[model samples]
Target: MADEEYISVEEVASIMGLSVRQASRYAAKVRTERINQRVLFHRDDVMEQARLKGIEHEARERAATYQPKPTKTDLVPAGEMLEYIRERDRQLAEVQAQLNQALLEIGRLQGQLTDHQQIRQQLTDIQSERDELKQAMERARPWWRRILGHD
Candidate 1:
C-alpha cells in the first residue's frame, strides 16, 4: 500500500478513468479530508470505490499501453487510389463535353428563331403590298371590273 496521505480529485479520477465531476460524486460516497484549504479524498478510498465498480484493472491496463488508430491514407493503397481519381476525372470530362454541345445547340436554335421571325415579318409586308396593288389595279379598271370581280 502507498502512504496514507490525502489525494487530489484529479489524481483519483485519472487512476479510475473518470471525469473529475464523476469522481467527485463517487468520492462523496467514501471518506475524504480537507487539506491546504482544499477538500481531498483518500487514495485507498477512491481505489476501493473503483474496484467495487469493476473498472480499476481496466484503467490501469489502458494506461500501460499506447497504440494509435489507423488513418485514411494508411488504410488504402496508393495505386488503387490513383485509379479511382483517374476514373472520376474521365467522368467529369465527359459531362463537360455534353454541356458544351448542349450550349452550342441552344445557340443554333436561337439563331433559327430570329431568322424565322424576320421571314414572318417579310411575308406580312408582302401580303399588304399585294393587297394595295390589287386595289390600284381595280381603280385603273374603271370600277366596272371590280363589280364583276375581275382584273
Candidate 2:
C-alpha cells in the first residue's frame, strides 16, 4: 500500500488497465517524480493514478477475464513430438513403396491370366477341328469296306 512495498509488474499493469510496458513507464515516472527508487505504489496513489487515466475500474474488471492462450510448445513435449513425426513419415514412405509393388504384381498377374485364356481358346478350337475330321472320315468309308478294312 505504501511506496516502499513491492508489487510485480503484472500486478501494476492489471491495476492500471495498461500493458506491462505502459505500467512500467508509469512506475518509472512515479520513481522519478515522487518515489526516489523503483518500488511498489501505495494503494491510494495507484487508485488515484488509475482514476486519472480513466482505467482503474475497467482494469480490475478485465483482469479476472484475461486468459492467455497456451503456447504450442507447451502442449506437446518437444522430443516426443519430433520422434512421432519422424516415425509417421517413415511409415508413410514404406506404405507407399509396398502399394507400388502390389500394383506391379497385379499387372503381371493380369497379363498371365490373359495369356492363359488365349491358350485355352486355342486348345478348344483344335479339339473341335479334330472331331470334325474324324466324323468326315467315318462318313466317307463304305460299311462293307469299313467292316473288312481291319482284315
Please, what is the TM-score per model?
A: 0.48, 0.48
Q: What's the distance in Å from true for residue 19, model 1?
A: 13
Candidate 1: pairs in clash: none
**Top lDDT model:** 1
Cα displacement (Å) at residue 7, model 2: 20
> What is the number of residue pairs that collide in model 1?
0
Candidate 2 Cα outliers beyond 4 Å, as residue runs: 1-75, 145-151
Model 1 CA lDDT for position 70: 63
Evaluate model 1: give its lDDT: 0.76
lDDT of 1 by residue, 1-151 (tens): 2344566666666767777787778656877886677667776677677789898787656434424446678987999999999999999999999999999999999999999999999999999999999888777886776788875
CA shift of 78, model 1, Å? 2.6
